[model samples]
Target: MDEVLADPIDKFISLYQRDHGFNYTLEQMHGKEFGELLPEELLPSLRVYLNQKGFFRDLKVIPGAIETVEKLCEKYEVFIVSAATEFPLSLEDKQAWLADHFPFISWTNIIFCGYKIVDVDIMIDDRARNFNPKIGRHLLFTSPHNVGLTEYERVNNWAEVAEKLL
Candidate 1:
């Protein structure tokens, strides 16, 4: 739920610009793997931000996400499935971030997995790598990174999600 529930790249870019003095827009990186698509020199340096402290702690919640998730939680089970293991420092930060913004989602429902092997009815995420046909329905939450991809059902924002799901 990193990009779906909150705008992590915004924070990442802000930090990258502040440190590296170069601005990288999210749209410029769309439809491609970041490490592979970005400049060879910049990729490794900018990637360090992912492992930094508080990278995931202070993320701005995506617009309409709180309202939509709250509404969904009332009628259906809601859980957070994050690839936290990939970035070890993110586990605590992501949990703290969720507790701060989405306290209604119990800690038990917050899962930290290396792979998106969740057995759920619906999976809402911005990353295309998380999509698996066997994992039931997949809703591609629109983000600059995944906006160009049309292979999966897309939700532009939580309003469209509320319209479609609720």
Candidate 2:
């Protein structure tokens, strides 16, 4: 759920700009895979960087994420769930990242697994397929790449999410 609360693409752009001079703005990256948007030669290495050390640690918090999550936590049993099996290398890094950025969240509240199989009243995620409608209502966290996915309820930013649920 880092993508729901962290701006990884912006962090990648900064790193990519420093190493390869790929001066892309976030708006232009909307609706496209960040790696595919890069020059072909850089794609492989950049994708490798995704799970590398220090990558998740430096990601900036998505605008309004901290405040919104704090508000939600006050009113609900907030769980910071993430699909972690795909990036085995990132499990610890992601946990460290959460502790570093979200000190208010307890270790017991974090759930890491392959599929998001938890049963809950609602789930907010950037990826559309992570939640099943029969199990819970899905609130799509609008990210650049997921902006065009319109099948579910979409919240453009945390403010909208707060408006809907809080």
Candidate 3:
């Protein structure tokens, strides 16, 4: 969900700038988690913001995501699999967000769990840890945190995903 279909980093930057009066650019966050760019004392506050209600509700959708995913659905069984159990409040927010943004996807196809243990033949995610190389083809979605990673095939944007999968 995050960094793949949604821009959570934009939310992080907004909240941080609104509270601390300091803005952070995506370049500043390259190859690092948002928290890693903050002062040690501010890390806890970032975590708190993530746990707050509605944090996941209005995230900006990645460019071309809706159109590309909609196209992919024509040829494949699409699922919006998100690791949401960690932030319990986000489950409802994410579901609502998906409903608003990607209404074509069915509720039964969404999976909100801690571990991404699915039997899909192809998985598209920003996190490399979620991929089981032996199980399927994994396409790494480019994000600031995963910029340095080069193990799997990488898709820099949704257009690239469309090019490769559609």
Overall local distance difference test of candidate 3: 0.93
Model 3 C-alpha lDDT per residue in residues 49-101, reported as the tens digit of each score: 88999999999999999999999999999988899999999999999999999
* lDDT string, candidate 2, 59-98, tens digits: 8888888899988999999998888767778788788988
Query: 42-155 in candidate 1: lDDT tens per residue?
Result: 777655888887888899999998999999998889988998898899889999999999989999899999887888988888887888888778888887667678889998
TM-score for each of the candidates: 0.91, 0.93, 0.98
Q: Point out the higher-scoring one by TM-score: 2 or 3.
A: 3
Better of 1 and 3 by TM-score: 3
Off by over 4 Å in 1: 32-38
lDDT of every model, 2 decimals = 0.83, 0.84, 0.93
- Cα error, residue 1 of model 1, in Å, equals 1.9
Model 2 lDDT on a 0 to 1 scale: 0.84
Residue 81 shift from truth in candidate 1, angstroms: 0.5
Which residue pairs come into collision in candidate 2?
A: none
